[model samples]
Target: MRRSTLFLVAFFSLFILLNSDTRPDSTDTSKSVTQEKVLSHSDKTTTETEHHGAAPSPYMVIPFLLLLLLIAIAPLFFQHFWEHNYHRIAIFLGLIVTTYYATVLNDFVSLKHTLVEYLSFIALLSSLFVASGGILIKVDKKATPIVNTLFLLFGAVISNVIGTTGASMLLIRPFMRMNKDRIKSYHIIFFIFVVSNAGGALTPIGDPPLFLGFLKGVPFFWVVEQVWLIWIIAIALILAIFFMLDMNNKAGAKEDQQYSGKIEFKGLKNLGYLAIIIVSVFLDPAVMSWVPSLDPLPVGIREIIMFGVVFAAYKTADKNVLKANEFDFGPIKEVAYLFVGIFFTMIPALRVIADLAKENSDVFTSSLFYWATGALSSFLDNAPTYLNFMSAAMGKFGFDLNGGAAQTQLFLQNPDAIQYLTAISVGAVFFGAMTYIGNGPNFMVKSIAESAGVRVPTFIEYIIKYSLPILLPVYAVIWFFFFRG
Candidate 1:
């Protein structure tokens, strides 16, 4: 309790410091103007300049790197300490970066933007986590290789409808239950690869990055039109691999239990709450002009609605269903706390990447776009990475990212522009499967599986054992077949 109080006090202190002196000083006006010129030349808005400040010193990225390193290693080496104080550690590291931006850089706008983004992120994730937890699914069938493969395939498809986060939160518990007798780390890993990331590539509703693209003037159906083939090829390849792996495992249900081949479901009303959450995703002013803006405040009506769902869903949830699902707050809490640090410290890293991408826009090819966007999206937030690369791609064709839907349509009409955009979209969505932190759903899935006593891999093990060996080859094939030009 004392620790929780300290955490709140420190958080508000950081907030107060950032909000105190947001106006630029007279002495800094000239520098701000010069920085604005560079930013504008890069096709960024003045608002973006306010959000990112000048080109951050590359050295400023150290805190982000360090936080990621600690997140990866601390749990492996210092399990107890990390499990207990991760929130404090995350806040402490976030404070370092926030203090730098607030005092040394005097760029409170960036801090505020990060805060808003963090809130929206948490609001969406927490709502889905809570709402889905109230529902219970029981699959009374023997876990077979074909059955598991089909289940994952269905999950991938529905991900486009309810979103990767929604699908993951809804299906993971049932999936674990079905495979309880033979569940392995590979089961969860493949789930992450297919449902949580690659499955979401076909629609804006499927993933945050694609949704941002839709807001930026890309047609709502454009992703499906462009990437459907790539999505099919990738998902098929992944599912095949999962099938082959599953075939080798001979584990079956215990001798005392028999399969009834029946599926049981409860808490159907939460589906209405999920539909409301999905509808609320479009409540942003950027998407619906009729939606009022809450400028200066990071969140708007959408976030408020989603957060309200979190409270309402939990309060009205059936106790029997909740107990059946073993629902708790542990997974969401971990994602919320760790991601705050990630969002704060990653400001400079994103800025540096944005600057580099813009400066070299003229020379970049579609292949480069795929790899660069994919590499960064593996660690940083894929949504912003998608936007940054799209901005650079648009600049390469003499267009502005903020030039409204007409300008974006004009850019998309160019054959070359389509190629670049496709690569960026695919990279951002597909490569998000490369790490647990790549997308919002990955970590939550991992946390849920662990809480259920699944033997999940460590962060490094996930990368070295599964990602490099499996996903890397598949992504290379995708690039070769589609974006090699």
Candidate 2:
């Protein structure tokens, strides 16, 4: 705790010294866009926006790095404290970061935007958790290598609809159950690669980071068009590798007790609730345009609808169904706490990256953006990391992504900027498979696999043995074929 406190103090002291000059200059105006229009379109903003286009000093990004470092190291070194008190650690850092943004910088507009983004982010994740938890799929099938590969294929496709978390939760157990008699650690590892991370590249609804992109003004269908080919190639190569690996492994004797029922889906009503959530996300912006008086009505309405769906699912679904799924609030709560800090501390990093991208546009080609975003995403949570790179790309092009339809149009029209955007999106989603902490579902899948008596690899073991050898080569192929000019 004391170390965390001292780190916060050092972070803020450095930030204060770096950003001593707070006043905007003449160049700030020309580069900065219309703040009112930007605010009117996004979340939790007052009618004020600032176009301080002078590149932010890089030292101001220390807090963001500190937050990422804590997230990476805390679980490894202080498991008990991190598991039990992650929220407290997150709150401590979040408070200091928020105070810095609100008081020292007096830039509450951007801060509010970040806060709103966090809220929308948690709301969507929680709603998916609740809705998907209610629906349970029970399968009674033998675990052949072909069956296992096909199930993974199904999960990879369903990930775009039910989300990586939802699809992972809904299927991991069934896959584990079928393969219980002949399980290998590699089975769980491949599941994480295909279902938990790479599968989510196709759509905004597929992953938390992509959903963040959707909320930030990227069109709902943009990811599909941009990432579909990469998604196909990645998933195909992963499934093929898993099949080969399974073929080489020797199977143990079958379990004495076998499940003897047809494939069943309990709490089916949650599917309807899930559909409602998807439709609300898709229609939020377009609906908001129809109601002129309600300038910032969509986020609130979407959030309300999301919460309502959660409530309805909780009330309608049986307690036994949730118990069967081992549904709990720990994951969602962790995401909420940590992301609040990430969203706030990332302000300067995003601003600086954008400024650098604009001035040194040649430095940010498609391949460089791909590897940079993918490497960071492999260790840190991919959502904020995705937003950071997107902000940089937007900065490179000298425009805010907050200008909903107009910004989308601008991106579609600019081929170079679109290439960077596509590379960032693909890298953020695919490389999340490199480590357990990279995506929300990776650890969850690992936990579920362990509870079912599969001895999963330790963090380093998993990355070095499985990810580096298998996944890295596949990603290299993606870069060579798609991102290389």
Candidate 3:
């Protein structure tokens, strides 16, 4: 507890220092369009612009690479040290990059922007984590191939309504409990593939990248309209594979064991909290002009409401339900610590990639866009990758990224631009399953499963055994069928 308190203090202190100079230079209106690109469009007055300095040095990306290496191998090589010290390691690496930006480049705008994103990310995740933790779903049915497949299919469909993170938090426990007799790493892996990634492709509210797209002027239903077919194909193929794998598992309840074949739900009121969190997701000024923006603070009314849900849900939660779910803060704590480092260290890498994409925008096609966005989003944050590629694609036809809703509408009117946008959307959402760090929920789900005593694969093992073998082929099929032009 002392260590946790200290860690929180250190984090907020650093955040305060980083935002001490939140005043944007109104006189700097002559900056290039790249420099002027708005990091967060929700707040008109306090929007974070891209760093207005010379492009970041490519060598500045070393810290990010090192962190990734540590994340991938440390648990396998030195489990004790990694478990106890990971927070320190993540924060240290993050501070290294934060110092470089503040002292060397004197660029606080980018830091503030990344910090805001981190807050928003953590707020939503923690709220959903707490709220879902309060609700316990128990399935007493026999675990059969068809039943498991239907369970995954239901998770896939509802993911479009509640968002990937929400759906993942809400269903993972029940799914695991249902398969307790034969739960394996592959079960969790397939959950990540379908529910946490590709399943969210059908709605803007389903994923952060698509939500950003909606804020930039895409219609609310544009995602479902454009990618419904792709979503069906990807989900169906993955579920089919999962079904085949489940058939081989000989583990099951004993022949004489009885089953209730009923579904039990508890802590019903937390569903209201869940509903509040979902509704608060759209309370951004960019989405609704009446929503107030809390500029310079990085968080807004939505985040405030989410953090409140985190508190209220926990306080009102039934003790029995919490115990049944084995609810604890372990998973969220790990994600919050590690992702702070990722969000900070990857800033230079994102800026570099954005520059390269812009420089070669004219030569890029939908296929190239698909591959490039997928490759980077597999490791980096997918939301910004989606935005960067969308910007570059728009620039291909001479549209400003900061041109807001009207400009985005114009860009979409072009038939070719529609193709590029479709590819970018699918690639960003689908490829997020390629790695644990690819999306916020992937790591959280892995942690939850690990805490439940399921033997999860190592990070490298996950890629080598599961993702590379399963997801890559499916994604290739998607590209061939949809983005081949």
Best by lDDT: 3
Taking the tens digit of each residue's C-alpha lDDT, what string does model 3 give over 147-200?
A: 999999999898888889989999999999889989999999999999999999
The whole-model lDDT of each prediction reads 0.86, 0.72, 0.87
- Error (Å) of candidate 2 at residue 81 is 2.7
Maximum-TM-score candidate? 3
Residue lDDT tens for model 2, 95-171: 66666665676664455545555556666767877888788887877677888899999999999987887788778
The model with the greater lDDT, 1 or 2, is 1
**Tens digits of per-residue lDDT for model 1 on 1-485?**
36754785678566655555555434334344544333221122123522446556788899899989988899899999988888887787888888888778777767776776778788999999999999998988888999999999999999999999999999999999999989999999999999999999999999988887887789999999999999999999999999999999888787788788899989999998999999999887666667776654556788899999999999999999998888888888888888988998898988888888988999889999999999999999998899889989999989977665677899999999999999999999999999989999999999889888998999999999999999999999999999996
Error of 2 at 85 (Å): 2.1
User: Mind sharing the TM-score for model 3?
Assistant: 0.95
User: Cα miss at 236, model 3 (Å)?
Assistant: 0.8
Candidate 1 regions exceeding 4 Å error are 5-52, 254-257
Off by over 4 Å in 2: 1-63, 208-222, 252-261, 286-288, 291-299, 379-404, 414-418, 450-455
Model 2 Cα RMSD, Å? 5.8
Model 1 TM-score (2 dp):
0.93
Model 1 worst lDDT window (10 residues): 38-47
**Who is ahead in lDDT, 2 or 3?**
3
Q: What TM-score does each of the candidates earn?
A: 0.93, 0.81, 0.95
